[model samples]
Target: MIEEMGQQSLFNILISLMVLIAVWWSVQSIRFDLFLKDPEGIKAKGFMVVLTLALTYLVTSFILNYLNWSQTLRFLF
Candidate 1:
């Protein structure tokens, strides 16, 4: 169970990083109507989006762990 929780935490962190990177790429490369209309607004929107995702994932994982929902008999070995 401990091992599983560790792996899950690691996986969640990696996914969050990937999401942040994707958000960065989208914000940098795309010029959608909403974004093009206001550069500062677009920047703020992107920051909010990434922040929300990170916070949600962290909160959910914390709740899950607090509830002892970790899997058993799972290890990277």
Candidate 2:
């Protein structure tokens, strides 16, 4: 049980890191300075980015738990 818990935690961390990197890459690809000139618009964009990351994590975690994909992988290994 302890090993399973550890494996799940590690998987979650790996997924979170991947999601964060993807978000960072997306943000970097966008020309925010050219489009969002207004201070309020910039702030809103920042908030939206944070919200998007949170939602991504929540949705991915929910799907992972529901599917139990990690267990399947463990079995295969």
Candidate 3:
């Protein structure tokens, strides 16, 4: 039981990191130069990091919640 729990935690951690990186990578398509005073500046980079984190939180929450809901639904049968 302990081993299973450890693996589950590790899986969740890895999945979160993957999601975070994916979101960051996908966001690069946007043209930040059109909006920022200095698109390549430190502030622009920091903004991207913050925006990515917010998006990641929202996405991961939905994913984990869906998994939880699906697992619970199994009890209805």
Candidate 4:
């Protein structure tokens, strides 16, 4: 039982990291120059990092919830 829990935790970590990287990649093309006074500054970069983390959290939660819901469908019959 403990081993299964550890495996599940590891799976979640891997999935979250994958999603985070994907979100970061997808965010790189945005036009932050239009909004920030200094798009190339540290503050702008920090904002981007925060935005990526927030997006990743939301996306990962949704995906994990969907997977759990689907797994529960086995009881529908």
Question: Candidates' TM-scores?
Answer: 0.43, 0.54, 0.87, 0.95
Residue 20 displacement (Å), model 2: 0.8
Model 4 agreement with the true structure over 1-77: per-residue lDDT tens digits: 99999998998999999999999999999999999999999999999999999999999999999998999999999
lDDT of 4: 0.96
Q: What's the count of clashing pairs in each model shown?
A: 0, 0, 0, 0
Total colliding residue pairs, candidate 1: 0
Every model's Cα RMSD, please?
7.4, 4.8, 1.3, 0.7
lDDT of each: 0.63, 0.71, 0.91, 0.96
- How many backbone overlaps does candidate 2 show? 0
lDDT of 3: 0.91
| Leading candidate by lDDT | 4
Kindly list the per-residue Cα lDDT of model 1 for residues 1-77, writing each as its tens digit.
99988997887777667656665565565555564556568676786566657765666566556545445325433
**Mind giving the per-residue lDDT tens digits that candidate 3 earns over 5-63?**
99878877888899999999988988999999999999999999999999998998888
Instruction: Tell me the RMSD of model 4 versus the true structure.
Output: 0.7
Deviation in Å, model 2, residue 49 alpha carbon = 4.8
Candidate 2 C-alpha lDDT tens digits along 1-77: 99989997898788777767776676566565665666357686786578668867876677678668665777885
Instruction: Output the lDDT of residue 76, model 3.
Output: 97
**Candidate 3, TM-score vs. the true structure?**
0.87
Model 2, CA-based lDDT = 0.71
Error of 4 at 40 (Å): 0.8
